[model samples]
Target: MVNISSCECMPWYVGVFRIRQRLTEEHWFDANCKYYTHVFDKTIISQVLGAIKYLSTIPKYEKCAKWLNENKQNLSQYFLEGFKSSKPLEVLIHGDCWTNNLLFKYNSKNTPVDLRLVDLQVSRLASPGSDINYFVYTSLTGDTRSKYFHDLLEAYYQSFSKVLILSRRKLPFTFKELEDDVERTKIVGLVIGLLAIPGIFFEGEDEIFDFGEMTEENMEEIFH
Candidate 1:
């Protein structure tokens, strides 16, 4: 379980970033353009579609495959809609919020005292939910995620609220509104998990394989 007080730093810092994003940029790049044309895009929708196509062929995840196929377009629309909402709750997201991106400094008693976030390569302006999705989904096991989902969200909200109060700015939305924003963009977690979880099992070394040297048989082995 995540202790609210210990983890308060995260949401408070996130709120600070959110305020910074609002003050500096009135608008972000178009979501569709970012999704499709950006060089480092690694388009989530496309990857999820590919994963769905591949996973559908396997028997165990047939239902997931079917849902992916049925909702693929809807999923894209949800992302686009999140971008289009009249009053978007936008923020500067850490982009890569997984455990590896955080460096912790511990106190004499070995309790965590401070944390520094590294890797700003993917930072962007987007819904706060996008950051939340990346952080929570990547860091927690599925069972823990399911069990403490609301508690985690509440912890974040409390910290965010405190930050807003300190900054002398009223929170733009209530906790209920935050919940709605999260629900609206829940597909981000789903698509990200589908595309990324497989890589977690890739237990190879850091050595790079030269695909240029591969023959047809090698290609088959690589794919399999």
Candidate 2:
């Protein structure tokens, strides 16, 4: 596998403006809309917003809910700019690292022996932790993530460290630093999961929603 942590060069065509447009305009939020707008499916946007609004009602997440509500308009912009603000270690990352984008090949014994990542359109230069956080939060169950979070970090660090050594590149960051990066970039995972997971399961043509029919009350019901 390539030592992604050490690789610095990106394609000549990939520029900051393109990354900004992808993050701000094409993917999550529509810049033209005054309110928070999801670019892909309006129904999915409603569900995500409804979920956020629902969370705000709960006492425990009040602070989180408050922050999200206060910053809803700027959330997409924040996500785009966050890469530049706190990146101690940078690497080319598979921007969308969810389970569906991954394909695994199994041996005769039914054990997986090989892996491939698809959907390169969103790939960009960013912290390696962004990919890790996105994968674990979106792909794995909450229970699994909570229990094996540290173990997962350790495994990734060991593998990455080995690759760097083999390639004669100095290790860029310590294991602790990796953990910190993961923690710092975790909102990327959470935001993505909230936005994308609903659309993943609502696949049937019959389940398609009429955007005109959506309202505050029914939106929460749809999310539930």
Candidate 3:
């Protein structure tokens, strides 16, 4: 993690960014936090993109062309070994995510103030969908759930992919490689398999999944 000094450009955002930079799920936090934190902080959406941008900038992906001159050691291929589906970006991801694991508390005025991501037991280098699919699965719909889900994820993907445009000339993979990532979900049951964990289906009133949403379109949009 970069020092707070690095974020001097934006002081108010310092605490949020510093915490995210220093904390990797690799080292366990104190047990005081019971939920497994997969992510932390209300990362500025732009800053999240900034972190991914750093990855794309570190090495040129075009080295794949020369075969011998490749900067990365066929790194994407190594990561793909475990997956039966295609990939997009060969990027690092939160790996584990779902609404239940994310902890958010609004301030006194009911404004969002803190975000503590929990459950990193499975964080890994995987498709961005690894994170996105989880949210799609776990996020609760209010009377207007689908509207938010589609809007938020598309906003995420658009911002996430912006950095790659600069890497266009050196991109190692083909259009098909990227498209395959989104297409893989078209196969039945995959997204659900990733999201339908036992923890999310807890029994009893304390475990109720209800969020009191109304509107058939909202429900339909979530599953659609």
Candidate 4:
């Protein structure tokens, strides 16, 4: 059974988690913008807020956040950084990429591989690395987090171009320019996703097993 609270949701991250699987294909063709029969669940959101706080306390996440804070003023600067770097080749990003639900039929022919992202729930306008980071973080876990973060980030920057340095990106005055946004964003996104742990998605019948018991403490964590 897939546990939602163990997954990602925050800054509307829960939307991706709450998305009903049956509609994934339809939404994919629509460029990933899909809403739901339900709105954000306060109970689920509570758990997420608490989780973000708890996960942020972990050293792996903290080290990443600390580095971000030391350089750029905050996380939002990433959007601008990406917009400036790309070769006018922007496409919708599968904003959430912890798992790739879409299946592909591979051909042995030496043709360019064109990926069709199956779930469009998290798809939104963003840079190349947006989907890339999600895949790498979830695909690689544990020590993989330690070893490949920098290398993966560097590759993404290189894929964009030589002059598109993250250093030129703008950020809040409270923070300075950071040397690396991709690396910092990668870990931060993953941790915050766990922090905003989403509610479970179920097919029907108000499955009791799907939802974890909601406590007032968890609620306070979310809206706080």
Candidate 5:
């Protein structure tokens, strides 16, 4: 069973959200744009679309694939510009909150007693929902997520509330607002899963293409 308390730690440092402006201008925008351009030479978008098309052929991913296909155009826009739409209740989030990026500590009985997040390189200001959605979608099985979605949200909010009370601070937003934010930004999870989960699970011995050797010419070959 996935421990819900593992997610409670996300909102512990509310002060991090206050530094959004400097981080956005000095770090996220520059790094994100340069990453999309210079790293993949602007071919990452096409590769993502190709990956989505490939995913649509998988039986287990049919529903997710349908949603990805339907919203692909918006997803392309979000790839670079999603930060612009951050809500007023935004917080500094673990920008890459997938399964591999999280670490859990188990007690003597092997029950997860603690959690730690890794890879702070991509951390940025965004809705707490962004992290929640990404982690829930990418880490949990669909049935698990469907069963415990509300419980997870409740646990997260309770944790956030306890932290705020201990820090003598006001609740930044109501639970309803959090739910709305999660609803609005659910696409962040789906889009990220579409781009990442395939590569993580790919077991083919063939080298897809070296990032160092990537070019517009060979980028399309990744989907083949």
Candidate 6:
């Protein structure tokens, strides 16, 4: 068996865009309309749609109820639409950016030296937020997220901007634009978090799962 020591791990989402730019410019693949589609199953989409609709009916989500009720019918499509973007800004992203797909190596002083990402099979060309949302929402705790969210975003923007400069391409959008896109497409993470947090974290393996577990109490306690 191979033994690997745990290390600090943070995703470099900019590398994904950099690599895709190189591949497309070099004519490795048709970058026009061709992109990785079908990141998740229709059944999963249906389930999350159902969950969102259920959330709307709860008293806790009353503020969101208006929007959810208005959009539940098309919630699945909206979730999928979050994966798309203009060709200039689009790139291959590790669609599944959750913890299991990542590993890191550390120096003797416990500083992270390298990050290794596995499970490239689900990678796709999409908006930058596709990977960002997945990694941030899934990996970070509530306190850590609140504390470092701004700094983390700034770091990503700097790295991505540097890559764009190296590629000799004009920055397609400003840092604020990226921030707005993340906020707009946040539903993707919201849906995934809804399913992942309650199902995977709270429910024990031997326990029977219940739909009711997707409650405000559970979400606030577990997610926050």
Which residue pairs in candidate 3 collide?
36-118, 36-119, 37-117, 37-118, 37-119, 38-118, 38-119
lDDT of 6 by residue, 1-224 (tens): 01212212342544534466456432213223322122233334445555667777778786675665566555556666776777665666777777667666778897666677788766666777767777667767766666676777777777777777887877777888778778777877766665565545545665534544555345434322
Off by over 4 Å in 5: 1-27, 31-71, 79-87, 215-224
| Native-to-model Cα distance after best TM-score fit, residue 7 in candidate 2, in Å | 22
Q: How do the candidates rank by lDDT, highest first?
A: 1, 5, 6, 2, 4, 3
Superior candidate under TM-score, 5 versus 6 = 5
Q: lDDT of model 5 at residue 100?
A: 84
> Which pairs of residues collide in model 2?
none
Which digits, one per residue and each the tens of the lDDT, describe model 2 over residues 1-224?
A: 11222111111112222233324332322335633344323434444566677887788988876676666665665455444323447666668877687666667786555566679787666676677777777777777777667876776677666666765767777988878887788777766776767667796967766757767666556544
The CA lDDT of each predicted structure is: 0.65, 0.60, 0.38, 0.39, 0.64, 0.60
Whichever of 1 and 4 has more lDDT, that candidate is 1
Model 1 error, position 160 (Å) = 1.2
Instruction: Please report how far candidate 3 places residue 6 from its true position, in Å.
Output: 28
- Best candidate, TM-score-wise? 5
Distance from true location, Cα of 91 in model 2, Å:
0.6
lDDT (10s digit) by residue, model 3, range 120-161: 565544454444444444454333334354455444444433
How well does each candidate superpose onto the true structure, as a TM-score?
A: 0.72, 0.67, 0.41, 0.38, 0.74, 0.66
lDDT of 3: 0.38
Between which residue pairs do clashes occur in model 6? none
lDDT at 203, model 1: 77
- Determine which window of 10 residues in candidate 2 has minimal summed lDDT: 4-13
How many collisions per candidate?
0, 0, 7, 6, 0, 0
User: How far off is model 2, as Cα RMSD?
Assistant: 8.7
